[model samples]
Target: MSYGLDAHTIKSLKKAQKNEITEHYIYLKLSSFKKNRQNSQILQQIAQDELYHHNALKKFTGTDIKPNIFKIYFYTFISVIFGITFGIKLMERGERNSEKLYGELGQKIEEFKKIANEEDRHEKELVGIIEEERLQFVGSMVLGLNDALVELTGTLAGLTFALKNTRLIALSGLITGIAASLSMSASEYLSARTEQDSSRALKSSIYTGVTYIITVVFLVLPYLLFSNYVLSLAVTIIVAIIIILVFNFYISVAKDLSFGQRFFEMAGISLGVAVISFIIGYLVRLFLGVDI
Candidate 1:
């Protein structure tokens, strides 16, 4: 019962069918590994819905479609590395374009409309129920990442002009970054201990410290690789921007945030501080009569 669907419509329906089936398997795999009973049940329900949608489409198309194996592994790996909430939300974000397509097809087919509505309403509600520890400590991670970006970018910029040596700048940035990360972690642990358990507080601090150190490594890599301080400074700034872009994008998708505002605010502050610090470094070098 293709319902007299045109060739193009059949092709579109087949694509949608494939997506539903693939997602079904992905959700099934995720549910199987989930330790939380409630989360596992919710994921299984969503998977069942996806399978239902696939079967509905199969009735119309009169064909069977295999799930996308690569997508199955890719999303599962992402869910394992990143939190399940983030990974699933990211995958669902990609489905927005497909939702639009579903809307268009719904105008002609009643079944498409039902599928679109269920996808929009039910799956979202189910996905919202999933909770992960990493997401709960996102604030700690953000604090660490933001501080590292702003402080280290400025510190590196200032040192680049003042020291005039890439190796020296790298060594100075590494020392400063490590010290700051430790300080930030301790502060986070203390703060979290006021409101949460000792174990949770420890985890929060670890997240903050690890994020800060990783960011520090990325920003300092250019200085270690390049000979000229100015060139290394430029590359570090680029790396900083890229980090801001990626992190904000991940947050925006996972948390349903406005990406542009958070991104510009962060990047502006980091770079602005770097500029001011650069001037201060030059002034100090001139006035203090210090040579490196």
Candidate 2:
């Protein structure tokens, strides 16, 4: 059954074989963490498919290959924190990138092409059937997260310039953040109720509120830890950028959106507002002769 592949083709097959094995391990581990019977079953099915691919490729190399231990743990951890859909989609992006390699190999070997087609078919089927709760309420989470980022970042930046005391700025920011979170949640609840059912509205508000509070806590942590106002402000801005980066990456993976564009837009707007607020605060402080 020798297809008489060249050295380069053989090497490529081995690399792909390793990737398949790695995904098999990752899917198996992720399935264990899922409480939902359907999701667990789907993951198990994917794992088996990956194992089959690994074995088929093993015939070419005439040797067994070990899975990547690092990737398995890394993606498993990502699934635990970010939800199953996000982790799976992120992994799928890797697989998509390898499609060109598959096509190249397929041109040389018919078996490789057949396998690539079958895998693509399976991917489409799996994607259509997947359902995750977190993804379902993503809009609500986005509303909360974006509002918190824009509003709190601007407010804190203004306070940082207006008040020189770290403790005082942090205290003021905390109080304002809590109050804004509650107001945002209530507004979201009302808006959702107007558009959807009461139950969904309530759930949406909860997601929004929880997300907002979490964002606020992260944004204010630097001020609480650092005594220097300028240093705290710098850390807080960095934290805000990181939050934007992480959230945009997750959304881009799960929803098939543009990561760079969304990330830069969100980050730019937040930071731009902060800069404007800082200037405004500085002018107000100077005009009022406030020395705090």
Candidate 3:
């Protein structure tokens, strides 16, 4: 049976069909990366569902659409590095963006409504079943990353004026960051041990330590590369802002939270600390008669 789809409707349908096929490939590719048998099976089932959706849409469009290969590998690589839950949740957000259009199309053809509902079900089921190891240690990551950002940003800002040399600032920041990362990891391990399994506690500590170290590297890179102290300080702060933006975006999508509020709140706190620290550094330098 052929439905009367006008040019505009056909174009829309084709776009959706392309999305379906692309997602089908993405899910199919990501399913292989899951180590947990149950999670793997669930991903496989979702992939098959996507394939079914693609075939159904193809019937309407009358032209077989090729999947977007770039998206397939891109999402696959993301899943490999960021954990399957993050990648899948990000994809779910994409599906949700088109929900209203699907509803509109449904008014013309009932099949779209069914597809939309199925997509909703997929998202809900995914949220419930996803058990990635990385997600389990999110609290640890938050602890490490947040502490590093706040502490290091303040420390670097203070040092920027007090030390007033790019090389010296970078060295000081590295020493401080490394020491803090170890301390934070140890504290996390002890804290987690009190509440959970030893293995998980160890994993939490590792996550915290790794996250802190990575943040430190990025934040300190500007100081290492630039000769001008003021320029290095400016670049370091900008890098801190970027890190906050990217991290908050990942968490917002995976956890389904408000990105703007979290982003602004975090950015404000880090910059505020830096500003206050900068002032204190200047006052201390003036009072102590430090010449470097």
The candidate scoring highest on lDDT is 1
Q: Higher TM-score: candidate 1 or 3?
A: 3
Task: In candidate 1, list every pair of residues with a backbone clash.
Answer: none
Q: Return the TM-score for candidate 2, rounded to 2 decimals.
A: 0.94
Residue-level lDDT tens digits of model 3 in 1-292: 4687677877877877888889988887787887778887888898888888888888888889998888788778877877788888877767754676778777877888888788888988989988867777777888888899999999999999999999999999999999999999999999999998999899999999999999999999999999999999999999999999999888887788899998999999999999999999999999999989
Q: Could you tell me every candidate's TM-score relative to the true structure?
A: 0.93, 0.94, 0.95
For model 1, residues 118-137, the per-residue Cα lDDT tens digits are: 88985568557877777788
lDDT of 2 by residue, 1-292 (tens): 5578778877878888999999999989988987878878888998998898899898898879999999998898888899878888888888874567777778877877877886787668667867788888999999999999999899999998899888999899999999999999999999999989999999999999999999999999999999999999999999999999999989998888899999999999999999998898899899998997
Model 3 vs. true fold: TM? 0.95
lDDT score, candidate 3, position 148: 95
C-alpha RMSD for every candidate: 1.8, 1.6, 1.6
Error of 3 at 137 (Å): 1.3
Alpha carbon lDDT of each predicted model: 0.91, 0.88, 0.87
Distance from true location, Cα of 15 in model 3, Å = 0.8
Clashes of each: 0, 0, 0
